[model samples]
Target chain A: MNFLAIIGRVVLALLAEIGRLSLFIWQSVSHIFRPPFFWRLVAQQMMRIGYFSLPVVALTAFFTGGALALQIYYGGNEFNSESIVATIVALGITRELGPVLGGLMVAGRVSAAIAAELGTMRVTEQIDALTTLSTNPYKYLVVPRVVAAVLTLPLLVFVADIIGIMGGFVVGTTTLDFNAGVYIKNTVDFLKFDDVMSGLIKAGVFGFIIAIMGCFHGFHSKGGAQGVGRATTNAVVSASILILAANYVMTSLLFAN
Target chain B: MSDAKIELRNVHKRFGSKVVLDGINLTVPKGQSLVVIGGSGTGKSVMIKCVLGIIRPDRGEIFVDGKNVLKMDSGQREAVLRKFGMLFQGAALFDSLAVWENVAFGLIQGRRMKRKAAKDIAIEKLAKVGLGPEVGELYPAELSGGMQKRVGLARAIAADPEIIFFDEPTTGLDPITADVINELIVDRVKDLGATTLSITHDMSSVRKIADRVAMIYKGKIIWEGPRDRIDDSGNDYVDQFIHGRAEGPIGMDVLKP
Candidate 1:
C-alpha cells in the first residue's frame, strides 16, 4: 500500500509539472501577438541568442564533421565503398547533424544563461517588479527570447551545415587522400534542397523547445542561489532532452510521406 | 468595497499543505501609507503579490479602486496594473540595464514614452533620491546596496503611479541607509499622493512611513491600527514581534523540538 501511494504521488507530481509547463508556454506564446511589441528587445535578444553563439556552434559543427568523415572512412574500408564518404557527409550534415548538434550546443550555452538570469530575477522579485510597473513579464522578457531563438536557430544551423560540410571535405581530401574535385562533385550531386530545409525546420522547433524550457524552469524557480542553480541545471537538461525527442518526432513526420 | 484604493477580501492561498495566506482581509485608503508588519513567512509578501496580480489567491476577491480585479480578463487586469509601482526587497533592478534605464523602464516600456523623454524623467527621479546623473550611467552591480535601493525607489516613482507597493524597502541596508530610504519613500509618496502599501519586518520603517499598520501572524492579520497606536496595541503577538522577542506564541520552524 505504501509503495502504491508513493507511485501515485510521483504520478500526480509529474502531471502537475506538465500542466504548469503547458500554462507557462501558452502564456508566453500568446503574449507574442499582444500589443506593445518591443522591437528593440527582440533585436537585442537575436544578437545574444544567435550572433554570440556563432563560435561555439561553428566549432561543434566543424569537429563533428571531421569525426564523421573519419568514421565513414574506417567503416567503408571493408566494402571498398570509402568513396561514398563525400555524399554521406553532405547528406548527413545537411539532414541531421548540423541542426541537432547546433541546437544541443546552443541549448547548453543559451538555455543555461537564460535559466540562470531569469531564475536570479525570479528569486529577487524582478519579475514581480515588472508586473507592478504595468509590464507583462511574458511580453517584456519571454517573447523576445523565444522569438529570437526560433529565428536564430535555423540561421545558426544553416551556417553549421556549411561549416560541417567543409570540415568533412577537409578530412576527406587531406586525411583520406580523396580527390577534392570528385568529393565536391559527389556532395553537390546527392544533397537536395529538401534535406537542408528539413534540418532547418527541425532547428526552428528545437529553438522553441530550448527557450521555452529555459524560461519555464527559471520562471517558476523558488528559494535562492541553490534554487537558481537547480533551475539552470533543469533548463539545460530539459532543453537537450526535448531537442532530441522533438527531432525524432519531426523526422518521422517530415519523412512519413 | 467602499472605494478603498486596495482591498483584499478573505484572500486564501496555500503552497502544498502550508497555508501561506488564510483569509487575509485588508484595506488601504487613497493617499495613505499602510505598512504591514510581520516576521518572515507570515503572508505579508504573498498578500501584496496577490494585489499586484503576481500571485492569484485560491479563493477571494481583490479590488483595486473598487474594481474586482480577480474577475477581470488579462487585458482589463493590465489596464488596472498601469496605476501601480513597486520597490522590491533586493531593489530588483534590471542588472542588464544601466541605472537610468532601470529607473525609466516603466516609462519607456510600459507607458511607451520615447527614450529621450524617458531619460529626462529618469534623471529627475534619480535626483529626487539623491543620486547624481553620473550614478545613473552605472549599472546596478556598481551601486552600493543603499544606492540600489535609492534607484529602486526612483524607478518605483518614475511614472508617478497612483498606487505603490514596497516590499522590505529597507532590508539588507545599514541603519542610516534604511532611514534615508524611508525618508525618500515618505517624500515620494507625498509628492505623488499615491496610496502605498508596504510590508516589512523593520520596525523603524513602520514607524517612519506607516499611516496605519497591520500585523500578520500564521497567514492572518492578527492586529491592525494607526502607527501611533502600535506600541499600545495590547496584543501579545504584536508586542512580541515589535519588540523582536523569540520567546512568544510565534515559534521559529526549526525550534520545534
Candidate 2:
C-alpha cells in the first residue's frame, strides 16, 4: 500500500507538470497571434538562438557523419560496402542524425541560456516589472523565443544536413579510398526529398519543445540565484529528453509504411 | 476612502501552508505617495504586487481608480496596467538591452512609438535621473548599482504613467545614494501627478517621500496614518518597527545559538 501511494504521488506530480506545460504553451501560442508583436525581439532572438549556434551544430554534424561512414564501411559486407556506406550515410544524416543530434546540441546551449536569462529576470522581479509597464511577459519574452527557435531550428538542421553529407564525402573519398564521383552519385541516388523534409519537420517540433521547457521552468523559478541555477539545469535536461522522445515519435510516424 | 486611487480589501496570499499575506486591507488616495513600512518577508511587496496584478490574491478584491482590477479580463487588465510603472528592488533592468532601450521599452513596445522618437524621450528621461546621454549606450551590466537604480527610475517614469509602484526602491544602496533615489522618486511622482505605492524598511525614505504611511506586521496592516503621525501611532508593531527594536512584539524566527 505504501509503494502504491508513492506511485500515485509520482503520477499526480507528472500530470500536474503536464497540465502546467500545456497551459504555458497555449498562452505563448495565443500571445504570438495577438497584437503588439515584438518583431525586433523575435529578430534578436533569431540571432541569439540560430546564428550563434551555427559553429557548434556544424562541427557536431561533420564529426558524426565522418564517424558514421567509417562504421558502415567497417561493419558491412565487402562486396557492397562502399556503395552502402555512401547511401546509408546520406540517408542517416539527412533523415535522422542531422535533426536529432543538432536538436540535442542546441537543446544544451540555447535551452540553458534562455532558462538562465528568464530565470534571472524572474528572481530579480523584472517579469513583474514588465507586467506593470503594460507589457505581457509571455508576448515580450516567451513568444519571441518560441517563434525564433521554431523558425531557426529547421534552418540549422538544413545547414547541418549539408555539412554532415560533406563530412561523409570527405571521409569516403580520402580515408575509405572510394571514387569521389561514385560516392556523390550513390548519396544523391538514395536520398529522397521526404527524408530531408521529415527531418526539418522534426527539427521544428524539437525547437518548440526546447523553448517551451526553458521558458516554463524559468518563468516559474522562485527563491533567487539558487532557484535560477536549478531552473537552468531543469531546462536543459527536460529539453534534451523531450527532443529525443519527440524525434522517435516523429521518425516512426514519418517513416512507417 | 471613496476617492482612493488604489484599494485592497481582505487580500490573502499563501505559499502552501505559509501565509505571506493574511486579510490585508489598505488604500492609497489619488495622487498620494503612500509608503508601506515593514521588515523583510512581512508581505509588503506581495500586497503591492496584488494591486499590480503580478500576484493574484487568494481571496479579496483590488481596486484601481474605482474598478475592481482582480475582476478585469486580460485586455482590461492590460489597459489598467498601462496606468502603472514599477521600480523593482534590484532595479531589474534588462541586462541584454542598452540603458536607453531599457528606459524606452514601454514607449516603443507598449505604446508602439517610433524608435527615433522613443530614443529622444529615453535620453530625456535619463537626463532627468542625472545620467548623461552617453550613459544610455551602455548595457545594464556595465553600470554600477546606483546607476542601474537611476536607470530603473528613468524607466518607471518613461511612459508618464498615472500610478507608480516602488518595490524597495532604495534597497542595496548606500545611504547617500538611497537618499538621492528617494528625492528623485518624490520629484518624479510630483511631475506626473501620479499615485505612488512604495514598500520599504528604510525610515529615512518614509520620512522623505511618503505623504502617508502604513505598517504591515504578520501579513496585516496594523497601523496607518499621515507621515508626521508615524512616531506616535500608538500601535505596538508600528512603534517596534520604527524604533528598530529587536525585543518587541515582532519575533525573529532565527534559531538561537
Candidate 3:
C-alpha cells in the first residue's frame, strides 16, 4: 500500500509539472502575437543568443566533421569503398550533425545563461516589479528570447553546415589522400537540398525548445541563490534532452519516406 | 468607504497543504502610507503580490480605486497597473539595463515614450533620489546596496503613480542606510501624494514612514491601528514582534526537543 501511494504521488507530480509547462508555453506564445512589441529587445537578444554563440557552435561542428570523415574513411576501407567517405561526410554533416550538435551546444550556453538570469529575476522580485510597472513580463522578458532563438537557430545551423562540410573536406584531401577536386565533386553531387532544409527546420524547433525550457524553469524558481542555481542546472539538462529527443522525432518524420 | 485607495476583502492564498494567506482583510486610505508588518513567511509579500496581480488569491477580491483588479482581463489589468509602482526587497533592478533605463522602464516600455524624452525624466527622478546624472549611466551591478534602493525608489515614483507598494524596502541595509531609505520613502510619498502600501518587519521603518500599521500573524492581519497606537495595541503577537523577542505568543519553530 505504501509503494502504491508513492507511485501515485510521483504520477500526480509529473502530471502537474506537464500542465504547468503547457500553460507557460501557451502564455508565452500568445504574448508573442500581441501588440506593443519590443523590437529593440528582440534585436539585442539576437546578438546575445546568435552572434555570441557562433564560436562555440562552429568549433563543435568543425571538429565533429573532421572526426566523422576519418571514421568513414576507415570503415569504408574495409569494403574497398573508401571513396564513399567524402559523400557520406557531407551528407551526414548537412542532414544531422550540423543542426543537432549546434542545438546541443547552444542549449548548454544560451539555456544556462537564460535560466540563471531569469531565475535571479524571479527570486529577487524583478518579475513582480515588472508587473507593478504596467509591463507584462512575458512580453518584456520571455518573448524577445523566444523570438530570437527561433529565428536565430536556423541561421546558426546553416553556418554550422557550411563549416562542418569544410572541415570534412580538409580532412579528406589532406589526411585521407583524396584529391581535393574529386572530394568536392563527390560531396556536392550526393547532398540534396531537402537534406539541408530538413535540418534547418529541426534547428528552428530545437531553438524554440531550448528557450522555452530555460524560461519555464527560470520563471518558476523559488527559494533564493540555491533555487537560482538549481534552475540553471535544470534548464540546461532539460533543454539538451529535449533537443535530442526532438531531433530523433523530426528525423523519422522528415526521412521516413 | 470611497476614500480607500486599496482594499483586500478576505483574500485567501495557499500553496498545496500550507496556507500562506488566510482570509486577509485590509485597506489603505488615499494619500496615506499603510505599512503591513510581519515576520518572515507570514504572507506579507504574497498579499502585496496578490494586489499587483502577480499571485492570484484562491478566494476573495482585491480592489484598487474601487475596481476589482482580480476580475480584470489582461488589457484592462495592464491599464489598471499603469496607476501603480513598486520597490522590491533587494531593489530588483534589471541587471541588463543601465540605472537610468531601469528607472525609465515603465515610461519608455509601458507608456511608449521616446528614449530621449524618457531618459530626461529618468535623470530627473534619479536626481530626486540624490543620485547624480553620471550614476544613471552605470548598471545596477555597479551600485551599492543603498544606491540600488534609492534607484528603486526613483523608479517607483518615476511615472507619478497614484499608488505604490514597497516590499521590505530596508531588509539588508545598515541601520543608518535604512533610516535614509525610510526618509526618502516619506519624502517621495509626500511629494507624490500617492497612496502607499509597504510590507516589512522593520519596526523603525514603520515608525518613520507608516501613517497606519497592520500586523499579520499566521496569514491573517491580527492587529491594526495608527502608528502612534502600535505601542499600546495590547496584542501579544504585536508586542513580541515589535520588540524582536523570541519568547511570548510568537514562538520560533526551530528545533523541538
Q: Candidate 2, after superposition: displacement of residue B73 in Å? A: 1.0
lDDT of 2 by residue, B1-257 (tens): 77899998999999879999999999999989999999998998888888888888899989898989888999898899899898998998988789999999999888889999999999999999999999999999999899999999999999999999998888899999999999999998899999999999999999999999999989999889999999888888889988999888899997888
Docking class of 2: high
Encode model 3's per-residue lDDT on A51-84: one tens digit a residue: 9999999999999999999898777687644458
Pairs clashing in candidate 1? none
Preferred candidate (lDDT higher): 1 or 2? 2
TM-score of each: 0.97, 0.97, 0.97
- DockQ for model 3 equals 0.87
Q: CA lDDT of A204 in candidate 2?
A: 96
lDDT at position B20, candidate 1: 98
The worst-scoring run of ten residues by lDDT in candidate 2 chain A lies at A73-82
Judging by DockQ, tell me the better candidate of 1 and 3: 3
Tens digits of per-residue lDDT, candidate 1, B84-184, equal: 88898889999999999999999888888999999999999999999999998999999999999999999999988999899999999999989999999
TM-score of 1: 0.97
Q: Which numbered prediction scores highest in DockQ against the true structure? A: 3
Q: What is the CAPRI rating of model 3's predicted complex?
A: high
Instruction: Tell me each candidate's RMSD, in Å, in order.
Output: 1.6, 1.5, 1.4
